[model samples]
Target: MSQTTARSAPSKSDIAVVPPRRPSPWRDRLSRLDVKASPYLYIAPFFLVFGVVGLFPLLYTGYVSLFDWELGDDNPVFIGFDNYVELFGDDQFYKTLTNTVSIFLLSSGPQIVIAVLLAALLNARLRMPTAWRVGVLLPYAASLVAIGIIFANLFGPNYGLVNSVFELLGLDRVDWQANRFASHIAIAIMVNWRWTGYNALIILAAMKAIPREIYEAAWVDGASPMRRFFSITLPLLRPTLIFVVVTSTIGGLQIFTEPKLFDAMPGSNNGGSTNQFQTVTLYMYQTAFEGQHFGYASATAWVLFLVILVIASLNFLLTRRLVR
Candidate 1:
């Protein structure tokens, strides 16, 4: 019996027949948690930063808008909607709104048209293409304040380059800041100059992403360049066009430095002699800094934000319709 037990128990194969050890519960739980929560842990930083910096300040700004707060005043009077009511009643606000909309339309409309054309031109196979693209983006990279200063000199009534050119051609020198309309034109010119190339570059990137087979198919069908652009390129590029339009609208509505500097000459207080070029943003700045009405300025900012939101929503809806 002892010999039989030794033969059954002492064999290495018999010893190796023990069941495989089970994994520890703690290690299994840790592995499961790592698999489930690793993604969330990676993305948590974005939410935390946005909550702290973006959402909190936006909520605070909204709360601050419903008050009678001055820059130097110690007490902020709780005046619900009074600032908004006063804003509505103020002629300056209406004027600023009109100018903002006008400039946005004027600049964005032509910018879209010109940008589409330039983008088409750039989409063609060309030598030194990257250099050309960089050249186009130069103005956008330049400082807005510097652009404003340069344009101010260019649009000067006397001894300005624009006036000099007009005189050389025996044409009348335009009084660029004499009225609201002319000031709007000047601001539009500056905006268009600065943004057109940037928009064109964006559209060009979109155009390049389109499959070459579509263009080749159109070409085989004897489609002209313009026909291909209208039927194929524009349709495919609709989403990019909408993006450019919305961004342009936002920038144009918030135009400040160009108009402000243009009107910074003698006898031009709140953006030109007639306040024609004063955008809502410019007005907000003047209200906060010059008029010392901080609450009113905040209200103006909120109104401007709403205007941008509405316009952007409309653009998005239009884009959806076009896409369909």
Candidate 2:
């Protein structure tokens, strides 16, 4: 073999050719910035709108409350917390708050009881199940204005359905709207009528989520229906019950339209004579619109908001502790 030929054949294997890298489909389809930001973009509109409509008004209202502001003022007088001071000292404020609490207690007890009982009954297999469910929700579906009007007529001082029933039963016809307790009871009855079925539906949904096996085991152990309910159902339903409680308290505290419209006496907007049935919202409206005390009304509103917040927080804590 010649030296030149041996040298030329001395090289090992040749290097293989490499293909250029391909970009990922996802990366190609969307920009890196867009991929990272899509989730935030999707949820931004709700918060943006809320900030515009809800948060701005809330903050502006608080600012307004710090001044002796009213409609048609040349310049709002900056009075730091004086409106709030007056609000706290005012006797009518306390009266309205007291009335609100009275009605809440009176209504909430019967409302919860009726809701639980009805939920339990509806949980059972019935002949006309769909019809029963529909019937239960009918009152809730009715317009609030209509409900108020109908209930007002039903509890009228004279010729009311409730009084007529009492007359038939050889009982004295009690004045519903005249007496303090009676007025509370009438308002409570209306609240329960409008709300019981709605609460029942929530409870029923919770009940249905309970495992059938647990009930079966209890039944095999000779637990009565009521026993199983107390032992198995109620214990399992604590979370849902807490949710219902918080929501109900919040809603009950904010009740405005029902009482406003339900007063049988024409053109009565101050809740009742001497503010017997007045809620905080009603008082605030009356103060702002009727009395034209804008700053004071705004202060009243802030105080009411704080009160509701504190109460709801305490309720949540207490109930959570009880459960644990």
Candidate 3:
């Protein structure tokens, strides 16, 4: 009884156990950003260069389109809407516009189809798959200027290989540069020849990403190769196909190199002797540099730019819907 120790009274602090605090949402977000910092830094240079060179030029062009900007002159004459007005009244503008659209249709339609077919072939179990892949991209490595010149000779008015073949087959030698339809077709051939393999490679890459399991499953269901391509591959490849289409359209609109060189004399600046193969881009070039009407060319650029925007939007919308 005498040895009883004094005991401390029960205090809330002694009895209670404190729990650890959870991190704030802001801190968590900051940590996540820290983890992703490397990737963002890696891609920063591309965005920076693109913004500086690509975007800046595009924006500057828009601004210049609003004024009369003459080459070799620092003083930009502020003439609002005059250039646009003149472009509408110009007959050559309409002709080139129609020509551009026609060539785009002719080139892009067959290009996509042939690319898909080629991609399918490339995807097949064949010897030297790697070699075939490399070979397909060979045209891409060749000089576009050389391609244009060679094609020009092939479709020449007389003594060209194409005409010689036609003569052997009892057909008349079609003057490619002289007629509108023939000229467009010739340019389209050039376009297809140069770009089809590249497009095939693009679609092939997309096709490779598709799961073999899906294809095997389709095969197990007795689906033929063509059926599987149409049902499974095509559906999965829609997004990639859309990307290809949009990019092709953009490149198609800038169809200067092939058509410009398609002339009898390379670098004539005029599309052809009669301007039969003149595309919108060729017209823009002639107007800006040859005719020295920088302001009008800018206006033409803006018109085509708007048309591209509209067509791209429509393509995206239509593709999305069709895929669904």
Q: Residue by residue across 1-324, what tens digits does model 1's lDDT show? A: 646766766776544554367456798899899999998999999988998998887777677789888988898999999999999899999998999899888888898899989988888888999999998899999998889889988988877899999999999988887866777888899989999999999999999999999999999999999888889998899888888878877777788877887885643348776787888998999888888888899899999999999998887788667754
Q: What is the TM-score of each candidate against the true structure?
A: 0.87, 0.88, 0.86
lDDT of 3 by residue, 204-247 (tens): 99999999999999899999988998899888989998998899
Candidate 2 stretches with Cα past 4 Å from truth are 1-35, 321-324
Q: How much does each candidate deviate from the true structure in C-alpha RMSD?
A: 4.7, 5.6, 5.3
lDDT of candidate 2 over 1-324, digit per residue (tens) = 445654676433311222146446676667776888888899999989999998998888899899998876779999999999999899999998988888888887678778988989999999998788888989999998888888889988898999999999999998877777787788888888889999999999999999999999999999999899888988787887788778888888877876787676665678877778888888998889888888999898899888888877877886677654
TM-score of 3: 0.86
Ten residues in a row with the worst lDDT in model 1?
Answer: 14-23
lDDT of 2 at 246: 84
Off by over 4 Å in 1: 1-37, 266-269, 322-324
Q: After superposition, how far is residue 119 of candidate 2 from its true place, in Å?
A: 0.9
Worst lDDT 10-window in candidate 2? 11-20
Error of 1 at 11 (Å): 26
**Ranking of candidates on lDDT, top first:** 3, 1, 2
